[model samples]
Target: MHYIYLHGFASSPRSTKARDLSDRFAALDISLSIPDLNQNDFSHLTLSRQIQQVEALFPPAPAPVTLIGSSFGGLTAAWLGERHLQVDRLVLLAPAFGFLAHWLPRLGDQVEQWQTDGYLPVYHYSEAKELPLHYAFVADAAQYQEESIARSLPTLVLHGRHDDVIPLQASLDFARTRPWIKLVELDSDHALTDVSTEIWQAIQSFCAL
Candidate 1:
């Protein structure tokens, strides 16, 4: 089985969770791809192109591909699975399905400032401080409505109980519509800091099936 690890928005392949997951999979001699999605020219790449890059990294045999995506990457994984990629299973961690709904409002003032200043301020959990602006522009992008994607593939969703970013209800709404989806609630925040073992166990069980 092949696995792909996708990091969240404004996050790199070097994230704590990514590194931990990589180490766990590596110990099992399983190959996984955790690419650096933090391109300075992210605005220039279309969503389709981003998906293409991910697909190109995998074999073409239509084998079962397990996708583990966090935040914006989860949204991208759902979109890819629905439209083009042949994913056997998916694990979405605090996915940002309502990106436009939530972020557009918060970023309303910063949008113009980013356009004018050519960058916007962002926070990095590792740095524990404010950082310079990084930009990602989605053009005529289709939303990843969880219900729509869940209809096609078996998915496992893990969300924090106290998640401040993407609400737990979004995943709950998805589970309501798609009976194949399983939800595992945690006590951590949006980053899912302390539940790595739980997440890995869930993945192992799903892969066994």
Candidate 2:
């Protein structure tokens, strides 16, 4: 089985969660590919671009893949699973479901200003500074509707009950209709950083490691 780890938005392969999970997989004598979704150009990020980049990294055919993603990356993983039969399983950490709806409101007036300016300055967790991302990011993301992901597969979602970003209800709603998904609620927040071990344990059980 091939393993791939996709980090959250504004984050990188060096994120605490990514590195921790990578170490855990390595301890099991397995390699996890954590690609930089930014593609060295966060200024013009798009969901389609990310999907293309990660799909290219997938091992040729017959080799089944297991995708592990966090936040926006988790959302990306779900769509990939829907589009590709090679994806065998998914492990999502606080996925950003209805992300635009939940996030755009937080930006408030900046949303309109970003449209007018064609860019918005947001904090980059990995880069440790604010980065100007093009408004095209929002335009591209709006094209992907969460309700369209109907393909069924073995999936596990680890969401924080106290999550303020992508409310817990999002996962609950998602798992409600999809019997193949197992939703595990944790005590942490949106980051799920405090319960890394629990996440790893769940992955091991779900993946049968």
**Strongest candidate by lDDT:** 2
lDDT of 1 by residue, 100-155 (tens): 66676778787777767765666755446556643445333443344566446788
Q: How many residue pairs clash in each candidate?
A: 1, 0
Q: Could you give candidate 2's per-residue lDDT for residues 49-82 as a string of tens digits?
A: 9899999999999799999999999999999999
Residue 73 in model 2: shift from native, Å?
A: 0.4
TM-score of every prediction relative to native: 0.83, 0.98
Best by TM-score: 2
Per-candidate local distance difference test: 0.74, 0.94
Model 2 spans > 4 angstroms off: none
- Name every residue pair that clashes in candidate 1: 120-133
